[model samples]
Target: MADLKLKDLRYLVALADTRHFGRAAERSFVSQPTLSAQLKKLEDYLGVQLIERAPKRVALTAAGEEIVERARRILEASEEIVELAKGHRDPLAGQLKLALLPTIGPYLLPNVAARLRKQLPRLELMLYEYQTDPMLEKLHSGEIDVGILALPVQMDGLDSYELYKEPFTVAVPTSHKLASRQSIKVDDLAHETLLLLEDGHCLRDQALDICSGADVNEKQNFRGSSLETLRQMVAAGVGITLLPELAGRGAYGAARGVTIRPFVKPVPTRTIGAVWRKSSARREAILALAKLIEAHAL
Candidate 1:
């Protein structure tokens, strides 16, 4: 069998990751027919089928799964070599792929990204927005160099540095009784219909944890897909919801008919942090970015 090229392995990995021909081709930056033909050649060269093809679905064969895992390791090692070389040049130079959660990105990034550009002019910053689980998955797979997310994340083989502790605030419609309060306590939430983000968001779980001390119940029939949606719901008097401090200062909390109140002493908060693979060669760059974010995140 002929030796496989790095690009071939990359295509296989993309296909394995996405499980769709069109998406894999787009990820690999190749045409669909080109990716298909190259994959066919790879299969012929290896004398085994990599994927089970159907009209509407793509499934990796057992062999494909094993090969894809090996391909990931090889690609990661190759990237590490490149990063090691770049590390000696300048700590903040070159491309850095960073993943951030949707909850934090809008409120925090706008303030920090400009500072980053001015401080590290040579740095090429690439950003991806995702939820905590997918962000961690990308970090572990070496698809992203770092992740900025809310902490207390329990994942092995990664290191994180706390940037800031962001407190949660109660958002209520102007007509709501809680809106008249100067401050709120966990007990105040009891028996209130709390609007929350849908599943897969860390903020939703964090809010639930804060409410655990009280008898707070969720708006079972309604789950906002984003914080903006929840803010809208609150402003419309649908239900009250929790907002991160930064978010409270943003446009969402400033919407008409909405009132924002801070929690009393021992306020519920989530620690935001920057996390990277423990073995990453871009540690200095990631740390540098973290420092910049920490300075402006508040």
Candidate 2:
């Protein structure tokens, strides 16, 4: 560790992440030979082999894995320090990564992103459309700086701030008997086939939990890989489905024969929130994104 420079640590960490010397070098903006040489020096200083090099790929040794884990935190901290210093001059002038849940991303990101780019001109925003599990993983791993997801996640080691609560609505075919009803109860669809997104979607789970007796995989009629697909299926009279309030607006406009009606008494709702690792160093950036989302959602 005595002779190990910050640059050398960085090269090793990059190699660990990319698992390719050439690509790591490209990411570090250094020549392959230079990065390889530094890595060799670091290994020599440690008196152990850190990487197993082959013609086309590289694998980390046990020691390399441990060191790389620590190196990632060091690099994160170093980057945070730089950002903090820069923010002293301008509060928002660095890269920010925000993860959005699949259900919400398509419906909300476009309108929000346009306003964000205009307001924070220097902020380089990276958007990731992800599901609940992967979104939380990225947040904890520092791969993503913020996440927009439903509340009641009850995840440890992260903080969530509720942006708003959106109600669930019933999606039915325009010609269906229940289409003209101002609001439909869960029991209204109890006898009808219920279309839902696949298992991975949180909304699917929400729908099932809300309607205890409703059949989710009524193979004869239930299916959709996305909200749009569900809307289309509902329009085709395949089955009725539940949709979030945010998605109801204009969701049926493009589809041929569908209508969105609110729920009757005891409606189900989901709380959407901004989530970040409690230990994150990018507090300001995370808060800024949360504020942006809240403003745009309004």
Candidate 3:
């Protein structure tokens, strides 16, 4: 039997991940026919049917599932080897893929990116925005190098460095009764209609936790997909929503008809942090980035 190539293994993993020929081909950066032919060659070389292919679906055989698990480790190790070689050259001069949650990215990344560019002039930063779950999945799978998200994620196999804590503020229409308050407590929001981001966003869960003991009820009929949308809803007098400190200072807060007010003492806050795999080879760079983020978080 011929020695299997790393590219073939990558293709197999991509197929397993996407479960669609065209999608896998796109991810592997190859044409559909080419991916199909290579997969066929791989199957013939191994003398086993790895996938059950139908017109609309793809399923991996039991052996294929096991092979994919091993393949992922091999791919991760290969990346570590490349990163190790690069690490010896420069600490922060190569491509760094950073994942950020939508809740934090728009409010924080501009300043952080500017600082990183000035400090590490040769660093090429690639930013990808995803919610917490998918971002962590990508980090563990070696698809992304680092992730910026709320801390206390409760995930294993990852190490996080605390950057800063951001407090949440209440956003309401200027005409709303609470908008005139100097500062309100969590209990003040008990009877208010709270607008929240959709389920996938960590901000939603954080907001819910803040209002846990209160009598606040989420507006079940509608959910904002992003912070801007939530701000718009507040401006339009739909319902009040919680905004992170940085977000409240952004354009949304500056928008007319929307007033942002802080919570009284012991405010609800989320700790922002940088996270990466514990065994990653780019630890030094990630830590450096984290320091820069911490400095600029204010």
Candidate 4:
């Protein structure tokens, strides 16, 4: 450890993450030869051949792979140490990279983006929109600072705060007889054709659970890729579907021939939350974004 250099470990981590010398060099902001030479120095010092190199690609040796894993942990801890020191100075007014599940991104971002810019003038915000799995992956790898996702991510090494629960409302064609109902219940949709989003959407799963609990079958004749598509399908009398509160508002505003109804019993709802790696360095900033969203959402 007497001769260990932070630059050497950083090079190892970049190589491990990118799996290509040139790309790793790019990430580390060093020339390819400089990165390669430093890695060679590191290997020589450790008395181990860390990587098998060829003109085409690079592969890690057994010890190299093991070292890479350790390198990742070391680099993460080092970065966290720096971040923690910075956090001690100021919890806000730093770079914040955030990701959100697709279902919530479009519906929620517009409402709060301007306010965030105004409130935290010195805070730089970077946002990404992704589905559940990829969003969680980015969170784990420290590729992003925080994520807004549906509840029950249930992943290890992450802390989650439940922001709010939004109920599911039924979407029906305005001309359909059931659209006139004072309130639609799951049982009421038993005989109705139900449209749904394609698989992988958490909203679709929540909708299915609500329908199943009431002994209603979701008709799969038509599936939409997005809430807007589902609204179009409902207006076309393709089938009925359930939408979250934000989506319901859009249908009410722009979409024609679609009526939203609250269910009488067994109302469907999903909890939205802010998720960050348990080891994250910006707890205060993450919570700040969560509070902002909660305030605007309500």
TM-score for all models, in order of appearance: 0.70, 0.67, 0.70, 0.68
The order by descending TM-score is 3, 1, 4, 2
Which regions in candidate 4 have their CA more than 4 angstroms from the true location? 1-89, 250-253
- lDDT by residue (1-298, candidate 2, tens digit) is 5776789899998899899988999999999999989999999998999999988778999999999999888989999999888776555767778888888887776657788888777878888888888888888889998889988785799888888787888888999999989988777776777888887788888888887865344545455888998888888888888888778774333567888889886888988999888887777767877787787774
Clashing pairs in 3: none
TM-score for predicted model 1 compared with the true structure: 0.70
| Local accuracy by lDDT, each model | 0.91, 0.83, 0.91, 0.84
- Cα lDDT for residue 183, candidate 1: 99
Q: Roughly what TM-score does model 3 have, to 2 decimal places? A: 0.70
Lowest lDDT sum, 10 consecutive residues, model 4, at 245-254
2 against 4, candidate with superior lDDT: 4
Better of 2 and 3 by lDDT: 3
Clashing pairs in 4: 174-257
Residues 1-298, candidate 4: write the lDDT tens digits.
3476889989987898788999999999999999999999999899999998978878889999999888878888999999888865777878899888777888877778798888766778898988888888888889998998899987799998888888788888999888899888777887778888888787888888777756565665666788888888889888888988776774243688898888776666888999998888888888988898888874
Selected candidate, larger lDDT, 1 vs 2: 1
Give the RMSD in angstroms, all C-alphas superposed, for model 4. 14.5
Give the Å error, residue 100, model 3.
Answer: 0.5
lDDT of 3 by residue, 20-46 (tens): 999999999999999999999999999
